[model samples]
Target: MKKSLICALVIYCFSSVAAYAAENPSVKALLSEMSKASQQLNYQLSYIVINRNTIEPLRYSHAVENNVQLAHLVYLSGPMREIIRRGGEVSYIDSSSEPFTIRANYMVAPTIPLLNSNINELSKYYDFVLLGKAREAGATCQVLRVVSKDGMRYSYVLWVDEKTKLPLRADLVDRDGDILEQFRTISLAVGDGVSKALGELQNVQLPQVLSLPQGNLTHTYWKVSWVPNGFKPEELNRYKLSGTNQMVESQLYSDGLFDFSVYVSDRNDQSLKSQLVRQGRRSLQIYVSGKNEVAVIGDIPPETALRIARSVKFSPVAAKKVADSNAVNNSPETDVAPESSSQ
Candidate 1:
């Protein structure tokens, strides 16, 4: 009797565990489905981007042909700007500049991580939660929230179609839960195969691929004293400023979703003072550290940007100089007694 009771208990426990797992699918599973659907499904999405006071309507379409991926995006109400991604190369066409192409895999659209990034990689920095259900873009959707674990990065709320597993709406929110930017789908169309127009786009003569000057692979001389969890240094390089043509040392950092760049330069432009400036959803923080000027720019809150700028710590050689300058500036001056005696 005792043995039979123990066996029954074990079976019940295993059944309960299996039921729970079935009811609650992992966040990674949901994201993986979204990623696969975005790539494999031939769909056209009409959406609008809302950043602060600016509202821009956009159109995006994706298709696969002969194992090659093709995507196109265009600003519906702008100065005539369009992006076409064919396989590994992306072409940009705009009224302000000549058409150009660059080597890239994914389309540079809003909510990039949701559309292209791997869920396993993004899970390192974010904690995903299933936020239940909603109706968006005339479809029943499952809402999911991706929050930064350390509060150093922005969070996102995504509404994905329940049937298609495609994203219908997304919101970029700050630490305080205020929405900074939003992408809302107006309409979406899924087809059995690639559209004829999109297929023909492959035959169009694309612009010559422009070769970007490579940055120096050497490490930077300075590092940040504090960074949010999962944040990692991406690259360190020196590049010339477009306006003044002045060389500047820059370091890039990312947490798989948001990216910020730190630039150190000798040129001190008073116009770019030690203050936070916000344009749309992006923020820029600029300050002077001893003789070098520092700038941090990204699509983050003002506080985050300011904190990153302040946390920058120079190398030992540079640290000493900065410390000495601070000491001299703060030291009280002594009286000139010898000058009085000579007079």
Candidate 2:
């Protein structure tokens, strides 16, 4: 009996060890390769970013020099939003809204080298898994699943070029298996970095991007009692739409990979009480008659957006002390965990 028990125990131990090793194989290598492809490779790509009702195809060129990444992004089909970023500084030339220059945070989404945090830092919320090979974008591609590590966030899958390790397509999906957005490359080149490819977009003029001035009286800050962990405020500005006397304050928040913008406007037409579902992304704009309204937009689910918006309560003093206002209950200690080699 004792001999049989010992044999079973040994077999179980070996099986457990084998399972763990198999589960983590090449995670570190795959992550490193993906980062190299995004951070160092020189590539010109024509890709598509698709939401449910909207489809946009744009061309992208990137270069890396001395460990600095230079990229130029332009919208191909819509109001031209031209942007150039090197290292941490960003310059924008968008003709859509007032044509003002703004400094974008390095970690904001749709921007590479997201928030200066690499795949390692974001891996806390998601896992990197290698799927079987496939053919895409006129080249062999490897599919990688960035599975959500927690229920608080969404998951993503990327189809990366096998030879270059450049992501040809990225699909963002919710827990219900619905794709929220899809980004894919239509064509690509793998040899040089973005700095070398600068010649391609050399003729394009980038508008002057300046940092936001301090003590802006127009911007208002509403002190929220709670926000989801991993979210941080990045920028704030105020505007009034033409043809109407409505006023609004736009505030952008980011959590390295994901960003959410909250727009505060007047309660004209009860905009907040009625659900606003545009571009297939559900959003909640909370407004009280004559009181300030809030529109929360991000890649998050509608329920999550609603929760955040509903939880917002104005502290009367925040408007005057916008710069000093602190986000409540969502500090890194309570939200983000220590970074370590786990895979």
- lDDT of candidate 1 at residue 135, scale 0 to 100: 97
What residue pairs clash in candidate 1, if any at all?
none
**How well does candidate 2 match the true structure in TM-score terms?**
0.68
Q: Who wins the lDDT comparison?
A: 1
Q: Which stretches of candidate 2 lie over 4 Å from their true place?
A: 1-25, 65-68, 74-82, 86-117, 192-206, 214-222, 236-250, 264-274, 281-284, 287-292, 316-343
lDDT of 2 by residue, 146-197 (tens): 7756555566777766677667787887878788888877777766444566
Best candidate (score: TM-score): 1
TM-score of each: 0.83, 0.68
In each prediction, how many residue pairs overlap at the backbone (N, C-alpha, C within less than 3 A)? Answer: 0, 9
The number of residue pairs in model 2 that clash at the backbone is 9
lDDT score at residue 334, model 1, on the 0-100 scale: 17
| Candidate 1 lDDT tens digits, 64-180 | 888999899989996999999999999989999999999989656663348876788888878899988899999998889998777777888999887888999999988878888
In model 1, which regions exceed 4 Å deviation? 1-24, 111-113, 242-245, 267-272, 315-343
lDDT score of residue 115 within candidate 1: 85
Tell me model 2's lDDT, rounded to 2 decimals. Answer: 0.62
